[model samples]
Target: DAGVTQSPTHLIKTRGQQVTLRCSPISGHKSVSWYQQVLGQGPQFIFQYYEKEERGRGNFPDRFSARQFPNYSSELNVNALLLGDSALYLCASSLEQPRGNTIYFGEGSWLTVV
Candidate 1:
């Protein structure tokens, strides 16, 4: 499966104009998610949530897992922190997963491994 790809991948604005972000998920996948690699690209695919249950996973090793709570909040857990595991984890929730306009990114939690 492919990671969510953002449209207008790079944005530079100061005119207070409206900016719309677009993210795409792989076919047959209803829910989508993405996150920022510590020192890497914009956002990388983490997993998809289908029918309120966790679905497809990305290239991440067994060390990574995401937990969704009843409050509609989700947490990405990484065991035994490592330099390579550092990243800023973010998520998106929507029944309409295709439209990026409805996609809202939260103030993600950053993990920095020493």
Candidate 2:
């Protein structure tokens, strides 16, 4: 089965434009989570959706949000983005905990804010 996948391997935007990142989870999986990884820092959890329901949320500001689809795919939306938002946006999927040990990540959507 295909592993988790993310789109627009890289992106660049001004300080206020919104961006939507996509993710498709492994077959049969029903959970997807979003994370932001700044340069030299570990990935920080953003939002997690399982079975189309919000499962957990991290300390991210209101600008960060995400949703899971019926097919187990997901999308992350960041509004009124900031320069500090420049980072590697990672998407991870799992079969259980969502935050479980079996989680796997994508190559990430690298965003650069100018």
Candidate 3:
């Protein structure tokens, strides 16, 4: 079975633009989380959805949003992109709460805003 999968391995955008990243979880998984990783910094949790409902959110601006479908796939959207937003967007999946579940991460979508 495949692990988490992400689309558009890389992307480049200008400030004020918008970007959307997609993810598909492994079979039987019911939770998906999104994270942003800046160079020289650890990943920052953006959002977490379980059974199509948002269960957790991190300290991000309103421009960041996400949704999980019935099938457990998810999409992360960022609006009004800024140079500061340039980073690797990662999607992780697990069977339940991330606290104890084995979370799996995708290769990540690299976004650069100039």
The number of the candidate with the highest TM-score is 3
Candidate 1 regions exceeding 4 Å error are 1-34, 98-101
Q: Model 3, 21-85: lDDT tens per residue?
A: 99999899999999999989999999999999999999999999999999999999999999999
Model 2 per-residue lDDT tens digits across residues 1-114: 778899989999998999999999888878888999999999998988889999899998998888888898999999998999999999998886654358899999999999
TM-score of every model versus the real structure? 0.59, 0.95, 0.97
Taking the candidates one at a time, how many backbone clashes does each contain? 0, 0, 0
Error of 3 at 28 (Å): 1.0
Give lDDT: candidate 1, residue 69: 44
Clashing pairs in 2: none
Ranking by lDDT: 3, 2, 1
Looking at model 3, which ten-residue stretch has the lowest summed lDDT? 93-102
Tens-place lDDT digits, model 1, residues 3-96: 4443534433333222233344333344556565566577787766554467667887666666544433444555555556555666565545
lDDT of 3: 0.95
